[model samples]
Target: MMQTALQVLDREYLEARCSLVELGAAFDRVDRASDHEENAGEFNDSRLELLKQALGILTEESHLPNRAERLLLLFSDLD
Candidate 1:
């Protein structure tokens, strides 16, 4: 679904193409230690919140009032 969105709106929402949540998770997992790295759940949580808010704006702009509605409309034939 994300790839679909990118293919459709890549030129317009270039910034939202990457997974902001996942990128922050990766960056936050980088350890200062020699062998092991702890998951930075807090950092990733913060990023998740921010990304959720940002995603809302993108969805509104894209006119996806409720994504599930769009998905159901698109796939209702399978039912």
Candidate 2:
């Protein structure tokens, strides 16, 4: 049986909200730690750029599927 939108939200909202909170906290920590550093160039790391791109994908309003796969592909290029 398919769950209604509200049902899905009820079941999943807390977990999703927590995940977002955790991600935000991690970014906050990074920013705070970077502020103490002497030479933290603006997004000097490729992983940070990838993380920003992944956040962009998450924030998109056009309902696209396979977001995890898309993010995986985005991160797969380690070179």
Candidate 3:
């Protein structure tokens, strides 16, 4: 269910959201082994996958669609 949503992001957006992209990169490094990191939960593939889902919602918004909910989703969980 979650992984499929991440893949859906590849279809909806061109450029990645800046903060989300950076957060993802940071998380990826931690995933690769770094331990001292912020947003540690983001490092898990499952969580990272969810962030992708959230980012897609933000970036694919048409002419800045309402993002208040999506922004909260970013700080919260995808499920």
Highest lDDT: give the candidate number. Answer: 2
Ranking by TM-score: 2, 3, 1
Backbone clash pairs in model 3 (N, Cα, C under 3 Å; residues 3+ apart or in different chains), count: 0
TM-scores, all candidates, are 0.25, 0.80, 0.39
Residue 30 local lDDT, model 2: 85
True-structure RMSD for candidate 3: 11.7
Name model 1 segments beyond 4 Å from true. 1-36, 40-43, 61-79
Q: State the displacement of the C-alpha of residue 43, model 2, in Å, after optimal TM-score superposition.
A: 5.8
Give every collision pair in model 1: none
Report the C-alpha lDDT of model 2 over 1-79, residue by residue, as the tens digit.
9999999999999999999999999888888878778866343677777888999988776666778888898889668
Per-residue lDDT value at 79 in model 2: 82
How many clashes in each candidate? 0, 0, 0
Name the candidate, 1 or 3, with the larger lDDT value.
3
State each model's C-alpha RMSD to the native. 12.3, 2.3, 11.7
lDDT of 1 by residue, 1-79 (tens): 2557657675645564466666556555542331253543323345445445554554564544666565444444564
For residue 78, model 1's alpha carbon misses the true position, in angstroms, by 46
Expressed as tens digits, the lDDT of each residue in 1-79 for candidate 3 is: 4668668788655554665578878766766663556665444567666766776776674665568666686777457
RMSD of 2: 2.3
- Looking at model 2, residue 31 earns an lDDT score of 84
Model 1 has how many clashing residue pairs?
Answer: 0
